[model samples]
Target: MNIRKRYLVLILFVAIALGAVGTYVGLAFFADGTSPSGNLASSDRDLLTELADQQETIEENMGKLSKVVDAFSIIQENYVEEVEDKQLIEGAIQGMLQSLDDPYSVYMDQETMEQFNEQIESSFEGIGAEVSMTEGNVTIVAPIKDSPAEKAGLKPNDQILSVDGESVEGLDLYEAVNKIRGEKGSQVVLEIRRPGVDDLLEVELTRDAIPLETVYVDTREENGKLIGIIELTSFSENTASDFENGLADLEEQGIDGLVIDVRGNPGGLLPSVQEILSNFVPEDTPYLQIEDPSGKKTRYFSDISSAKEYPIVTLINEGSASASEILAASLNEALDYDIVGETSFGKGTVQQTVSMGDGSTIKITRMRWLTPEGNSVHEVGVEPTIEQKMPEYYYTNPVQVEEPLTFNESDDKIENVQIMLEGLGYDPGRTDGYFNKETQAAVEAFQQDQELNVTGEVDEKTAEVLQTTIIEKIRNNEDDYQLEKAIDTLTE
Candidate 1:
């Protein structure tokens, strides 16, 4: 075969090996401008010879796909509505991927492909959150640090019920993402159903260009020792290099300890995290293992010979996912380091995006990534060595006020308001859902302190102020229990 033909054949072989294309129909569908002749082409024959053991299985599967071809022909010829061939083809591909029952395995159209490419290369105009389909709902994995989604108080695992008032039911992950993304400066309203909150919340966000700067470095003084902090927002393309440079700079400054925080980090490229892992994990054992479809496991190792001279700690929370989990698990399992914080957002599978000749692509979950100890954290997150919970108010849901909440109103919204009130130092008498006389008095006290109308009732203005004030306090780092624990672990 010629060079181009060889490359195409190799790509097809990879797709076939990955179970992405199991039959002649699937193969011919992506062949583009080529028609099936009930026989394999010369290149395909060569490829099949390479898979000689599976040739019988492939042929048997090919014989079973006549039903799909018949259905397509009937739909094209007899359906009352005129259907486009491209649409049907794409739908068929999407259907195959959906049959896997894995949310990470998705088919992306040309437009979504372009947007995905743009997001990886540079900035993209969107709400700036990593999301996945969970229990048939588009759920937020984590809002990017400082993005409009985070600034608007979108939290991890927040289920997106609708975008701009239109329900996202039955829509795939990519479709929901496309709906949530728009031009920079445009408005996108999201209806969120957060866990532990009774009433649904609506968040209005002004979309902006989301930059992909992943690594953030800072210094902290704890116990008369200088500690370096490297916070990874996401494991993007340059995150590994950026982290290396930042670590080098910190070392040059003669820091006593290091803290790696992946609190709200939604993972990105796999290679990126692998590169970062090599810096900490020694060559004594594999940092991680990849289990393929046939249950074959391949171990990957780093070349580092020695551990860091100073003490190191990893900080994680519910928003930490995929690559973040890998780094945390590897460091803890391989190096015996301490991990302090809440459990992570478990996502142990690794996805590989394969192009379908056209601009479209299919991201397939090719393997499950296991920790150095060969444990999978798919649905079960990594447990912290020393468990630490944030303040109660940190987990409070957003209060959506449909009407003024007066005394005797007992609902989850009232409970949220009470929690915020108490967290801000104004005692609501109790954190119960009931809005009693004391709760009303607390609202009045808060209103008066904030220089608002002392209506003694929680109204729209009061709800907004409460949310903004709590967000401000969280952003000001008035109470970061996890970071403090990490610093103490490192310094002690």
Candidate 2:
């Protein structure tokens, strides 16, 4: 094969391949056809012509490259075993990218790039959890709220031991996920080792088209104040619209205060979170401070703030990272909202996706981000105003409330009762101590959903089911201690 064909083949998985970026800087002169360097006609021609101008230099470098090509052809022609063209080309691509000495700078093939775009930009079919290689282990960062992973009981910091009976210990992060991810409706079994648990937990999950839980709105009346809660799973493609809708709905309801939950949420698109943050910050207030590799700093500002003025509290944890960290930091600096929960997952670096000649792309870390107050939460992470540790093994089996609960009774037990009610999707209004009309209706709905007696009261048996069911959910997901703290911060 010629040098041009080799580049095209290699570029199918390279960043500096001959097309999108123009032929490799030194190799473009040898390739025929209008320079064949890049899409930029003028620049490609000028650069190629410039290389052509130095005949001796071109010849010298071309000879070195030709020798390598000759060796490749000889190996393909006279190898002991048959060698596929694809194997030779892909190997070269991987070798080239590895030479960069940067793990973040990688050459992704078409399939891998497509999967990546589906993840960072949009949606995908999977168990609905964000994972990463932390401390040399494939760890679950966070299961998308209400996604298959959460429903199946996945939690933050859970170490993945195996996938579908195959050990994932030695596999790379991407490789492990590739093995775990599959077609929608297909089952992918994950064996996880939870903290403080000696026995490995076997988790059976069916991959589904994970819904974009970008922003979910839940409101409650605590202390006779209407509290609006927005759980942002990630700043996805639809996050801005969903967030705007949630805010509008809450504003319509005359929301008294706000509690934004970023717990167990891996951050997404930057613009989406920025849009959401803008709603809270004052107009023309600086939001983020970004510094490029060249040391140039840029500060972004908000155009407007939401009309609704209320006290705010944000919930964050180790799973809350990137854009989530940005928002939490911004909220504390600009709005001075009470940030509850644990410290955020520090991911202050920003990535830039550069498309290659083929359909592949390279996502390279290009810049570092800081809070509006010029604080970098990169490795150290963003700490919350109040720290709360979550309870573990709270739902291993069954659970029961302290006592039977009845509607219209104002008592402290009603708080846990309401918590369990809200946790079970019953929507018992504001989780206040008093069981109001909404709480009674939600109780009836939960009873009906569970096919039990349609009682608008949490009796002994009903309290057991509600507690156990919600506790199981909390077990599958992380503890709600962080969120509870945020609610308390807002209510207090």
Q: Which one wins on lDDT?
A: 1
Enumerate residue pairs that collide in model 1.
Answer: none
Candidate 2 global CA lDDT score: 0.73
lDDT of 2 at 220: 80
Q: Which pairs clash in the backbone of model 2? A: 22-37, 23-37, 153-476, 220-430, 221-430
31-82 in candidate 1: lDDT tens per residue?
Answer: 2214566555369777668568566665565446556656666787799999
What is the TM-score (0 to 1) of candidate 1?
A: 0.88
Give the 10-residue window scoring lowest on summed lDDT in candidate 2: 25-34
Q: After superposition, how far is residue 87 of candidate 2 from its true place, in Å?
A: 3.1
User: Candidate 1 lDDT (Cα, whole model)?
Assistant: 0.86
Scored by TM-score, the top model is 1
Clashes of each: 0, 5
How much is 259 displaced in model 1, in angstroms?
A: 1.0
RMSD of 1: 6.8
